[model samples]
Target chain A: MEIKLLTEHYDKKEFRFIEGYKKLGGYETLKKAFSLKPEEIINEVKASGLRGRGGAGFPTGVKWSFLPQNGEKRYLLCNADEGEPGTFKDRLMMERAPHQLIEGMIISAYAINSPKSYIYVRGEYNYPIKVLEKALQEAYDAGYLGKNILGSGFDHDMDIYRGAGAYICGEETGMISSLEGKKGQPKLKPPFPAIKGYLGQPTIVNNVETLAAVKYIIRDGAEAYRKYGTEKSAGTKLFSVSGNVNKPGTYEVPLGYPLMDLINNECGGMKNGAKLKAVIPGGSSAPILTAEEVQKTTMDYECLAQMGSMLGSGAVIVMDDSNCMVDMLKVTLHFYHHESCGQCTPCREGTGWIHKIVSSIVNGEGRLQDIDLLEKIAQQMMGRTICALSDAAAMPTLGFITKFKDEFEFFVREGRSKVKEVRAHA
Target chain B: MFKLSDEGINFVKKELARYETKRSAIIPCLYRVQKENDGWVSPESVSYLSELMELPEAWINEVLNFYTMFNKKPVGKLHVQVCNNISCCMLGARELTDHLCKTFNVKPEEISEDGKITISKVECLGSCDTAPMMQINDDYHENLTPGSAEKIIKGMLNGN
Candidate 1:
């Protein structure tokens, strides 16, 4: 069943504006949040067990607690750069509920005592950026943002920084680098964002969904918010379902919702009743799951992880039987190659190398040894980069080659895709 | 002699101050240049934006080249970009892109003979729900068949 917490007002077009959102009793949580002490709000979220809805799945409250105890000016960045392939839920939330995000950010900023925040949105989302800009203006006018918000004396300033199409910028430090007017590249950790980020200031970077959910946590209190999802993965999540599904779109469900049920109940079953072959349960970076494995899987961080996959960004890409695994890997590798920031040697070279080998296989130039060679190259690429882009490229390559080795071997021997009706290449 | 319009320059000025640092405004300013110019950022406009924003020329150029949205060269009036990534291609995005290219009598990333359209197969635009979608400039034409996509392009060619 669809448990619409953050997305309840999405169907209402008026919810985009402050007046409509206010009519739906929006920002009431912010007013209520102001009454509690900052530590109390932090403790409430900590007890709620709301994990980061971004790919990482870290506890949001625990991440906030990492902020230094001193009154050093910190930054709260909302990672709205939704560039992960197959992920579009963040775009929907921002387009439909900009104020919800802004209100949530204010409460988070108040809890962390950070005076400044930025929503680093992707540039291609021109419409969403315009929505957020207008909503920020509305927030300022209504006294929800800016100095002395609601006369609570918790001053804050929020702004939107547009990201210009580099996928790596979705990473928090990469986002911080982009916001600081540099190339969108990831920085070394240990002096993590909480310690040093974005012009050497302590920063708290949260995904758009993670920040927006804070409102609900504040509204219903921690216990009520934790009621929907599993014990560890509490609260509802929005899954961006696409590919061969009959109804391909965003659906909100509890964390432990069955992956098969999401397909049958929400997506209206497979398109044209095609049989499911494989599924990329997370975004492109995650490992692929076979049809049999997907049937037993749930949409939580722990369940997918135990299955040797991840619930990355909750982008469930469904592939039907007619699709060729070799062709799909080629397309996916091409994306990572194009988006690799070229800062890390492993990612910069490994992604291109993988794309070349995969493209050659698709173009009918693969040796039998090249199959294992692809896996060897992909294995070395993992955990060797400044960022996970290397691993992102490597993980999917490993998943595709291992799970669908038959399709790949068939292509290598016949020089034509076994599944594709016509020759896709040559 | 590449330059922004008076209004475009003014918008760039406001964007410079819109962010915490002037360098952060490079993306928005480059977007303004792409909008003012014929849908692409020329080499000279990099220098022009460098001077206008008062940021380093290398910095402006780095950001311009890093992003796919800021076209480095000229595109057609109707810059049709089809999302041929995994999700879209699984359905019919590749076939749609091929059909569009054949209809326009141009290869991918090339302008037609009449220069009315340019088709390029791009990465995903996050609109995976509506597969086989194309972004013609700022607007999206989703859930497309070959015939429907052709009709939309022809309508554009006929000044619709």
Candidate 2:
């Protein structure tokens, strides 16, 4: 069954506008939130146990607490740059319910006491940006945003910052750099964003879903909010189901929902009645899962982590027996190679090296040793770069090689796919 | 010699002031340049934007080169970007890309001979649920077949 906590009103076309949203009990939570003390609000969020949905699975309240209490100016940045392949839930959230995100941001800002905030959307999402800009204007006119919001004496200004295009910009520091009008590259952490970020001020960057969930946590008490999800991974999350699925779209389910139920029920099972071969439970960076492994998998932080995969960004990309794993890996590797920011040597060189090796294998020029070489290169790339992108590239490379070793070895040995009758592109 | 229209200049000005930092305005300003310069940002436009925004040329160029959306060279009026990432590829996006290129008589990343369209295979465009999709200019055409995509392109190519 769908949990629909955040997406309950998504089907209503009028929900996009402030007036329509208000008709459906929207922004009432913001008012309720404003009535509570800021510290109380923070405490409530901490009690709710909402983790960062931006793939890190970091506890959201803990992240807000990291901001130095020196009364220094801090920034709340909404990570709307949904560049993770197979993930479109954020885009859907912004497009269908911009004000929901806006309300959530304002409440988060009020709790964090940040005077200013930004929604850094990807450049390709021009349509969603347009919707947000209009919704922002409506929010301003309605006094939900801007100075002295709702006369609560908490002054906050929210704006949408368009990212030019790098996938790396999805990284918090990379987004901060882009917001500062520089190359979208991730900076080294130590001070982290809480200590020094976005023009050297304390900044709290949260995923769109994480921020939006703040409203519900405030609306329904922390205890009520905690009831839907698992003990650690509390509350509902929007899983973006894509690839060889019959009904692929964004589905909001409780954190510990069964992956197989989501596929069989929500997604209407594999497309064209093909047998499920594999799945990438999270976004592109998550390790791949075999059909048997996915059967026992639950969509949560602990379950996926225990299974050697992750519930990263909740982008479930399904693949059937019709697809070739090697070809899929080639495409996936090419994306990392193309999008690598080239700042860190391990990610810069390693992404290209692994992509080249995979390309060679796909091109039928692979030696048997190339498979081991990929594993070695990927192992070195992990935990070596300034950001997880090195690991993002390596994780899948390692996952594909280890779990689907037969595909790589067969491709190296036979120069064509063992599953599909047609050969992959030369 | 590259200059934005008065309207374009005004949009850039507003965007510069819209953000906490003027540098944040660079992406929006470059998008304006792309629109004004027929779909791509030129070197002259980069220098012009740098001078206009009072930012470094390096800063402007980095922002421009970093984003795939801000095309560096001229693109056809109809810039057909086929999504060939994992989900889309699983749903015949590559075949769609091939069909588009063949129908237009062009190679991937190359403009058609008549210069009406450019077919480029792109990564995921975030519409994977509606797989085998393409972003032609600003609109996303998803769940497309070779025939349907061809029809859409023909309509756009003929200005219909």
Error of 2 at A38 (Å): 0.8
Model 2 superposed RMSD (Cα): 1.2
DockQ of 1: 0.68
Per-residue lDDT tens digits for candidate 1, residues A332-405, read 99999999999988889899999999888888898889899999999999999888889999999999999999
- lDDT tens readout by residue for model 1, B41-69: 99999998998888889999888887788
lDDT of 2 by residue, A100-135 (tens): 999999999999999999999998888999999999
TM-score of each: 0.98, 0.98
Q: Evaluate model 2: give its lDDT.
A: 0.91
Residue A88 miss distance in model 1 (angstroms)? 0.8
